[model samples]
Target chain A: MSERIVVDPITRIEGHLRIEAQMKGNRIEQAYSSGTMVRGIETILKGRDPRDAWAYAQRICGVCTLVHGIASIRAVEDALNYDIPKNAQLIRNLMIGAQYIHDHVMHFYHLHALDWVDVVSALKADPQATAELAQSLSSWPNSSPGYFADTRRRLADFVESGQLGIFANGYWGHPEYKLPPEANLMAVAHYLEALAWQREVVKLHTIFGGKNPHPNFLVGGVASPIDLNSDSAINARRLSQVQDVISRMRQFVDQVYLPDTLAIASFYKEWFKRGEGLGNFLCYGDLPATNMRDRDSFLFPPGVILDRDLSRVHEIDMHDKAQIQEYVAHSWYNYSTGKETGLHPYDGETQLDYTGPEPPFKQLQVEDPYSWIKSPRWRDKAMEVGPLSRVLLLYASGHEPTRELARFALAKLDLPIIALFSTLGRTAARTLESKLLADAMQGWFDDLVSNIKRGDTRTFNEALWDPSTWPETCQGAGFMEAPRGALGHWVVIRNGKIANYQAVVPSTWNAGPRDASGQSGAYEAALQDQHTLVDSSQPLEILRTIHSFDPCIACAVHLADEAGDELIKIQISG
Target chain B: MNALKSIPVLVEAPATRDFCYQNTLPLLHEISHALRRLQQEQLPTTIDLNAIPFGPGDEQRLLEFLGRGEVSAHLEALGNSSVWESGYPGIWFIEHRNESGERVAFQMEITTLPAILATHPDDIAESLSSLQKALENPSLGHRIGD
Candidate 1:
């Protein structure tokens, strides 16, 4: 008998998603992954000032708002060819780095932890052992015996209070909670520590953005103007705070994250070999200089992997718009054959035929097919992006720090020195990346400070060429390393105003639909090998594990009421 | 072939937290009128762009400010902070609480003609001068908030 298992409204991860897996016996025979919702972000952007898109783009996804903000700005700058300032480049880099650290921490603890480590299992943990684990790590007082004792008390309080609002729907003490009582105790302690630190560190963004989730970085220069006097004083505090938070986080990664992942991963050593997606990885390089790229967009050097054969990723010029096309033959968007990125919106040529096929990634079934995301391939090949890609690129380029971090992390996790290119290697890869980036932030920070001391703190460039400054009226593509993965924004301009703004989001690449061939999107392919589903009610654990791929679907929600929907006139019917 | 005595350009606001149709609804007619008046003067329109395309942030500190996050996603929605919208990078600050006790998050919009429309070099110089003057000085007659 065929059983239809619908994991509707997949929670915890960003955006609205539903997974339909046809079960044959105990295994999932086929899968249908549907994002199911659509927001008219592209349609709304039509006929607006191009500069505003930078401000507009951040709303795409909370998980990677910085990516959206940068993508939008890069698109406009790519069209204008406006040179960004060096100080601004460092600031952007730091901000993006913080975002990566923040996102990964959240992805691990708040989202993915509950899947492996049971929340209720903490009750059975020996508080003394937990305290011992904490105190043994650098003799830190924050995780002392007293702290664990109190943490145990708080857990009791939470259960008694019935105000376990955050943990309301949690599947605590589930049978699959794999770990020793002592390890669970340690994990519970660090979970709280990570939460507090995550909240504390986001302030860096607030000081600059006036808020955090989606910060505002001015395109040409820094947004918060340096009132030389105010900056010297305020920056001292801000910079110190950033360093302190980063160091604290580093300790947690070294002491807690590494230990927790290993302790837990050891219990489920089976997963160490499963869920590797596509085998083809892609990463657009980061750390763009102030000048950006001239023609080939040396900003994010593309990194592509076809099967096992890896190639240096290159930018597809927006001028040659024909090269970058998205085929929705199997997507929710039913186009008239193949539609280019410049025109792939719902209204443009969308055909909503749910009758297309199962897991649309399988729709083409050749090389780059499967998934709802429009399979975004550069030069007709599937590519992988994000931490692994970054690590690989850094290693290939002989970045010693990244290589060292990778080696150290592998040693701790008891992972083989296989150069970190496996399905189960994502966790180690992300951890090592966090270390590399945390260290690099200091390097970049010192560089910026030295440059500042040398009297080179210019922040913006006003492009007013010798009368022949209409920017040649051509198209340009801007690719940047979003905290999540490969994020690219393509723009085609005609006579100054934005003619087309195409954003192939990180989620679009990672959680994309199938390409022309029958290859699974990154996330879809990753889910195929999963033989475990503890409880159907909590697909969240699995979703969290899958979403660790860091898929940010920005245009998943759209509220298109009558044009005059009095938004703030709260008719709070008491 | 142009007998346009009085023409007004309808400039739509970017899909930002502030300047959304929801927040600016009460004064839509006024904004439309102000936009018409600015077009007659021929200046680049001052507008609010949508800083975020998704929901508001789960935590307020995530609402970093550049030029965006100046508006609140809460005020733009129907309920008390919908997760779908709030999960996006959104913010809404209360300048003054409204009548229903639901505070209004607004954008200070100053619509002028496009700055690039100055026909001559002197005209361009004059246009920039006037634009800066307008930015520094908000016309009392076109005032947004009370």
Candidate 2:
């Protein structure tokens, strides 16, 4: 008999995500992924001034906070055919690069490490042994026995006090936990270090955009101005600070994040074999060396890799209506045409409809409409989008650094190329790309400083600042490779106001439910592939695979009706 | 200085009505519950203020309602942290700032003593051992001046 298991309000992620697995004994036969929250940011964006869209769209997800603002601004700029200065482009690159490094490191330590590292077990570890383990990993400065001893003491006190605080409800002693006590202690120590490190690095965003979560964004260019002699503008002091933040970021990624990921992966080598869901991958490349219009200058090139084929890279045209479409067959929504038909985001509609089983209920009616997220398919195929996809795309594109890093990590782990398609590979890919972006940030900063030195410090173009300059009707797809994966904002502006706006975020591509023809989304397919439960009641295996994608459900689902009264209250019970 | 003065300052009028108090009443209720738990079970609870979304003036109003108590402290570690007791005996307000002097966390901890104010046992032991060594060798005390 196939027994069903439900893990609802999945912890350690940005928003509410419920996973249901139909199991035959220990193996998972089928998995259903549902995003239970409705966020109607698109509905809120309708009829608003096109330029102000970024400010509103920035509120979509507090985790991947800056991506939507970038995408939204790009959409408006794309619609207006506005060209910003080279300085603006470089500053934007620095900010985006910082987001990628900051977000990826935090995810590795705070969000996903607990799945592999047992916190409670760290108390039993010998600090001397842990210091030895840490020294072997890398030349991180805080590797002395005394340092590990202090961390262990602090962790012991927190554990003994009967208050786990943020570390509570963890599957600490699960049989599935494979790390040694020393490794666990080392990881726990770095977890605390990462918390402090992240707080410092995010100052990069604050320096440029004025704040961290939902930083200020401008449609024409960045809101920051450059005047070297000035204290308030992008002066010498601020630029030097940006340089310092960048160096700090690169140091952490080089010394701490990279070595820690490899160490953790070495213990869980079996994970590199499983969770290889839907060999397909998609990337909307970002970090342009020149400008957005100059696609060839993109550091991370845009393309689609089908069937994990590194041979031939497929092209993606966001403007092509048939290329990218969202299917709502199993979603809690209805297209004006019908539920079965897929609509391109330019023509995307957000209609509030709840057809799933009401809250405080046992099982979701799996066969019917079950999720709030729309199944975004590229040419009607479920493609995984995230760090693994971006890394694979870069390697396939013959990007030398990405290729070298992947080879180095694979050689270190003694894993084959096929391992890049699995759970652990997805995580290692994030670490590799963080190094790539951190290095690339220095180059961008240098370019910006050189431009300022040459007295070409223009950050904004005032030509299209006035709405009267825009054509009566225009539409554009603003896309970027977010920290999570591919993110695109489709906008249609008529008469200087937003006629329609739809954002197909990264999580929607990976975490949406099965489609009309019964194609499993990335999350569902990965869960069903090579996954076996040690104990059905404690589904640590499920969390490992799901968290590998770094699911941000808040980015996936939108809000409810205008009054918000149409939202269904979901009550989760153990 | 002229460049700094040239920078535009964005200011908005406060909302006519205080929605934060109305919307964040549940937080007040949670504080009450934490107080009760402290009284009944002798248990302490910490509410991360950052976790709660406060509207304009909502945090200030809540702080004003909590008022001030006699006890307050300043601590420096990875950053600077301020802890103070509210008008209510058990409720304490704590704000932690990083090296950049940016507020990292603002929390309302309900306890007899905020955790940051208490010296860790390990630190206490280390302090005792250091003091003993300094007494044995007066020269060791000069190292602090160095």
Candidate 3:
């Protein structure tokens, strides 16, 4: 007999995601991933000024704030054939790089580490033994017996006081937990350290974008002005601050995050064998060294790797209508043509149709339309998008650093190249990429400083600032490799106003339900791949694979209205 | 050259704009639930303020309604943190800042005493050991006061 296990409102993530697995005994036979929330940011964006779209689109998610703004601005720029100054490119690179490092570090410690590390078990750890274990891994200055002792006591108090607070509801003593008590203690200590480290690094975004979450963005360039003498601009003091943040970021990645990931992986080597869902990966490259138009200058190359083939990387063109399309077959949406047909984002339509069962129900009607997220397929194939995809793409593209880091980590864990497809590989890849981006940030900072030294202080190109200069009808696609994976925004502007705007975010590619032809999305397939429930109620195994993708359902699904009148209303009490 | 003088005054004055989404009521309801839990079960609850989005003047309104209590404290660690009790007993507000003086976390902890205000047992043990060492060595004894 087969039983259905449901994990709803998956905690410690940005938005609501529900996972249901059909199991035969201990192993999962089939899995269904559903995004329950609807976000109609695209509907809210219709007929708005193309240049001002970034400000509104930036509100799609609080976590991946800068990515939507970047994609939105790039779409407008692409539509208008706008060109920004070289200084602007370098500054944008720094900002994007900062987002990756800050985001990945935060995800590893705060979001994903609990799946592997048992917090309650840390109380049993000897402080001296933990200190020795931490020292053997890395010379992170705080590796003293006293420090570990202090951390252990604090954790013990919190656990003993019956106020687990954030640590409550965790699968504490699950048999699936493989880490030793000392390792758990060490990981818990570093988790606290990462919280402090992340705050300092995000100051880079504030220095450049003039804020952290929902930073200011420009259509033709960055909003920051480069004036060495002025305090308000990207002056000498601010540039130095940027440099400081980069160094701090690099230090943490090298000393703490990377070492800790490897330490944790060594204990759980079996994880690399499972969670290798659909072997296909996709990346719409980002961090252009020169201009957005010049694809050759991109640090992370854009391409598709099908069947885990590192031999030949297929090219991806966002502008090609047939290349990228979204399917609404199993989604709570409708395509104007038909539910079976896929539409390119430029012609993408957001129609509010909820065919799923009403709320407060027992089980979702899995045979019918079950999810709010539309299944985005590249050339009608489900491809995984995230750190693992980017790392594989970089390694296949012959990026020397990624190749070396992958080799080093594989050698340390004594795992083969095929292991990169599994859940642990996905988590480790995030740490590796953080190191890569942190190092690349320094070079971008240097280039920006040199550009200013050469007396090229221009950050914005005023050529396309005037709306009157634009063509009457134009459409373009803007894409970037966000912290999660590939993020793209499509825009059609007619008479200086947005005619159509659609964003195919990272989560949509990974967390969408099965398609029309009965193809499983990334999350569903990965869950079906050798996942067993030790305790069906405590589905720690499911969380491990899903969190590896770092699902952001809010970015995937947008709000919709049946009447198309009032999209959302906020009730106020005076 | 004074760098401060070069900054242009971009705004003439603070714009009086109405922020439509008032989150104060829901937050107050949450506080009420926590207060009830404290009264009935004697279990403390901490609401992470960072997790909740505050509209324009919503935070100010909530704080004003909570009012101020007699107890407040300042603590320095990786950065500075502030803790204070609200007019309603057992409702405490805590704000943690980073070294750059940026607010990293804020919470409305409903308890008799905020957790950070209490000294850790490990720290107390370390203090005892260090004091014992100082007493044992007359030369190092003066350094304790210093």
Candidate 4:
């Protein structure tokens, strides 16, 4: 009997996402990934100031707050051919570096770790054994038995109260939880430590951009002002604080995050064989050098890997209309032309035509438009993005640190190179990327301080402040290697206003619905491949693969209120 | 450390009437008190947003006042639900919806971690039974649970 197991709202990751898998025996024969919410933030941007687009775009998702803001500014900057000051570039790099490290760490310990670690099982773990295990992993100072004991006590308290708190809703005691009690306790300890650590780390953004979530950004440069002595501006004191944040970030990633990932990953080596979706990977490389135009200067090189080919890399031209397109066939959206045809971002149309069944329906009409996420394709193929893609691109392009870390992780895990293609590999890739970025952040930070000392402190260019100097119309794309994947924001500026705006974020590329060609997106494809549910009811196996993508449906779609009003004014104006 | 000590305090964005929702002030106060209780007792509680009748203005004010923290999650497992941490620690906003993607439930889960995040034991037990049955009868085509 083929049973359909639905894990709607797969918890922990960002945003609302529903996964329905059809099982033949215990193996998943087919799967459907759906974004249940609809947030047409781009529509609100129409007729708004292009300079102010970042402020609005940044609201797209709270978790990936700064990525959208950065991408929006880049889109406007790219459209105007604006060149920012060197100080601005360095600060931007520092800000982005902070985001990658912060976001990736949170995802690991808080979001994705629960799939492997059994929290309830931690109650039985001996603090001494956990300390021994932690010490064996790395010299991370928090490996003392006392630390583990405190974490255990807190867990016991939460358990005794019958309120598991965040540990609630977890599949405790499931047969799939392979980690021992000691390992779980250690992971739980780090998870608590990370919550506190992140609070201090976000101070970097506040010091530089004046606030954390959705920091102020400007076209042609960053919004942060530079003053060596002024207390209010980016002064010497703030600079040192930024330095402090960087050192702390590096320590946490190297000591806690990387070591914990390897330690926990050793237990789930078989995961390296599961969840290899759409072997194609794409990366619009980020962390630029002196010149943003020069792709060769990017620390993480931009390229595409087709069919698991490590020998070659493909160029991704953002301007090439034939290269990237979005399909709305199986999505709750409609193109101006029709639902069957695809449209590039330059001509992207968002007509929210939700054709799915009304609420309270047990199962989605899988044969129809069931998801709000439009299927995005590169050259008519589903490509997986995020840390795995960036890491692979870095490795394929001979980026030294990426290759070293990837090789080191593979060696430490005793897994083959082919293992990098699976669920565990994807999670490990995020940790590895965090380490690489943490190291690279020092160079960017040092360069910024040196530039300031050498008497170059200009942060923004007022040259492009006036719209009258611009042409009547222009279109450009801004993309970055966001923590999740390749996030691109395209803008068509006309008459000094945002005429058309479309943001193809990371989750859209990875978590989108099936395209017109009926090819499943990364999440669906990965879930369908070699996924055998040990317990159809528990479905830990399904969550393992989907969560590996660190699925962020909030980035893909937006909040659909009670009105069931799907279309947010699909005004397709030429 | 000397340089840091002399640094001027950064000013926050001024409270403007443009974003304030006066009607929700009472509710905001209630939420504030709840948050205080959460801190004082280390007790987790749920504030069902759906239970309170809110106008559009009230909703806007609640969001502006609460702001957002670093972490948020959308769980589409059994239903569509959003779990976002508010600006305050231990204050989380959760919105759960049915299949049509309408908010069937909205809550402000005040806890160390939102209770909805962990899979309940009953759910696992039910799932275990379902899997056992599925294993016992692979040819049974009927849907087990709605």
DockQ, per model, reads 0.01, 0.03, 0.03, 0.04
Is model 4 an incorrect, acceptable, medium or high docking prediction? Answer: incorrect
lDDT of 3: 0.86
lDDT tens per residue, model 2, B1-146 = 12222333444454553443374688889999999999999999999999887754578668877799999899886779899999999999999998657798999899999888887898788778888899999787643223
Q: Is candidate 1 or candidate 2 better by lDDT?
A: 2
Task: Give the per-residue lDDT of model 1 (tens digit) for A1-574.
Answer: 7665666556667886656665666555555555655665654554455666677667777777677787777766765666777777777777777788888877777766766676667777677777776565444456666667777778878888878887787776666666777667667777777877787667667765667887876655567543223322224445556566667666666666665665666676556665665666667666654445632333334455556443343343433434444555446554444533323221123434344345433223322222345666555555566776667666655567766776766676676655365544666667677766676666666666666556565655555322246553544456677766777665555555555555676666666655546555666666665645666554533554465565455543321111211111111110
Q: Compute each candidate's TM-score over C-alphas.
A: 0.69, 0.81, 0.81, 0.78
lDDT of 1 by residue, B65-146 (tens): 1234322323222323211112112221222234223333323343221222225687567767776776888572332222
TM value for model 1: 0.69
lDDT (tens digit, per residue) of candidate 4 on A1-574? 9999999878988888999999999999989999998767888888888999999889888787799999999889888888999999888888999998989888888888888889889999999999999998888888888879978998899899987677677779998898999999999888888987887898888877778887888898878788875545787767888889988999999888998899889898889998988999999988898756778888888989999998999989887878999898998876667889987777677777878998888999999988989888999999999999988888888888788888898898898889999988899999998998898888888788777767788998999899998867877788888889998998888889978788898999999888888999999999988999888888989988988888888898732212222222222222
The CAPRI-style docking tier of model 3 reads incorrect
Chain A TM-score, prediction 4:
0.96
What is each predicted model's overall lDDT from 0 to 1? 0.56, 0.88, 0.86, 0.84
The candidate, 1 or 3, that scores higher on TM-score is: 3
Off by over 4 Å in 1: A136-140, A231-252, A289-291, A294-301, A309-324, A337-372, A396-398, A417-423, A464-469, A530-541, A555-574, B1-146
